[model samples]
Target: MTDLPHYTEYDTRLAAYAVIRDDDGRVLLALWNEGDQPRWTLPGGGVELAETVEEGAVREVLEETGYDVRLDGLLGVDSFVFSPAQRSNGSERPLKAVRVVFAATVTGGELTPEVGGTTDEARWFPLDEVRGLPRVSLVDVALGYLAAG
Candidate 1:
């Protein structure tokens, strides 16, 4: 849990994880399904009770992206307060979500479209091309850690 926007009693909130593949400075991204528009995002999901944040990240990557990964390091966190118009699943989601982003590696598993959850598609976009694409700035933060390493 890195420095994140606080969400206490303001509204419903949850914690999530973000996993970035260290590509010697490049990154892997996919166009997501659970967004207002098609947005490229890292692999992750909401944290479940009785599970650690890192474990959630691992499970989420496999579930959302069809890849078994191991958490390598903590990149940082992102706390988002979304409007109902932009909420994923199209309901009033948590007022905020503290995303515990991590740097991870592909341990095994084949990438396929079926594993893409609600995503329209799954493909890895390089780091340099990310900013130009329709992606959130949080992706850039994850990329910065990858570049430093």
Candidate 2:
């Protein structure tokens, strides 16, 4: 019998995000500072084990943007796979990211940047200007949902 290499187990990450837009034709975004270069993204992140997806989305939005949001409805889900070499965490196994996206409305709270967190800044960008901003792929996915809805 010939010896064979063992297969490595891949990891799956479940996250929640919100697409919040104001009546003034501006969309909320947070600067993701954990990567090589900071880029704008939706205000949300990994879902905690103890919370539901909806709860996670709300919590993440609050944490990143300092905005109290009420989720109106689920917009869509985005799935992407990162090869081991492409992962920022330096893991040897591939990672599958499953992101749950929701449409949300700001009920309260003011626009404030996150402190001591993965995101350093939060701001509202005019819809037309969003296309020129440096952002992650998730932003495009969320915007696609907005266009379709």
Candidate 3:
């Protein structure tokens, strides 16, 4: 739970995530082990100061799943508001989260778990099996974009 986002200040963050699928239509997902329990999510994280969202998505995928991937195109964006567990004031100060999702294809690398990172495991799950897994809304939203397309 220590690696989960904790807000000490109010700020808007822009993040990027990758939706990588194989020939079998199995999506690559990372198991985030920082919350109350591990949950599956698209491989992504906050974009760095000078990095483009696409580059950030590539980097996050590599860092989380050890997979090299090529960006296909921008799928869609997802946004939400939530209060961080650690807040300074007692009032509910919600952080606005804007996430950019990209359609991507794996270029290389093997499936491996991230070390000393927010994600502890990475795996490919069949599209139909994803709904049965414990996951974040990001996963559903990303998949929805693909479904709509």
Candidate 4:
């Protein structure tokens, strides 16, 4: 349990995309595996070198949730200071994380799970449900952005 592959760390920072969708006035919320923070979050991950943000968002959505996403808009940028508990790789360090939220539409894809996905489950949640969750503020940020559009 001590030795694990953490997706995000302090020294090895990462950028993630917050994929959002509007389905009958609801959005998709994935119970993402954020290592120690283990909570429900949007699907996303680090941006690859030479890959644009939009590309990263799409890729992350597919990789994390097995969903092919079409980026509709960007929600916002968020920065978080790494804490001792958030380290997923079973390392002792704080992880500085930067995430770019995006409003995307599910153009085509199936609701499936990534191989060894961080999330144990994925499901659709209303904006109110997202707002009430006790976890990172990404969902709220995404909802606000979605409402803006």
Question: Which candidate wins on TM-score?
Answer: 2
RMSD of each: 4.7, 3.7, 6.3, 6.6
Please give, for residues 60-141, the per-residue lDDT of candidate 2 as tens digits: 9999988999999999999988888989889988888999999999999988888999999999999899889999999999
* Top of the candidates by lDDT: 2
Give the Cα lDDT of each candidate: 0.68, 0.93, 0.89, 0.71
Instruction: Order the candidate numbers by lDDT, best to worst.
Output: 2, 3, 4, 1
Please identify which of the two predictions, 3 or 4, would achieve the higher TM-score against the true structure. 3
lDDT of 2 at 130: 88
Which 10-residue window of candidate 2 scores lowest in summed lDDT?
Answer: 1-10
User: How many residue pairs collide in each prediction?
Assistant: 0, 0, 0, 5
For residue 98, model 1's alpha carbon misses the true position, in angstroms, by: 0.4
lDDT over C-alpha atoms for residue 110 of model 3: 88
- Candidate 2 colliding pairs: none
Greater lDDT among 1 and 2 belongs to: 2
Candidate 4 lDDT over residue span 101-125, tens digit each: 8778887788887677666666777
Instruction: Compute each candidate's TM-score over C-alphas.
Output: 0.76, 0.93, 0.87, 0.76
Candidate 3 lDDT over residue span 24-95, tens digit each? 989999998876779999999989999999889999999999999999999999897767554333545667
Ranking by TM-score: 2, 3, 4, 1
Off by over 4 Å in 2: 1-8
Clashes of 4: 5
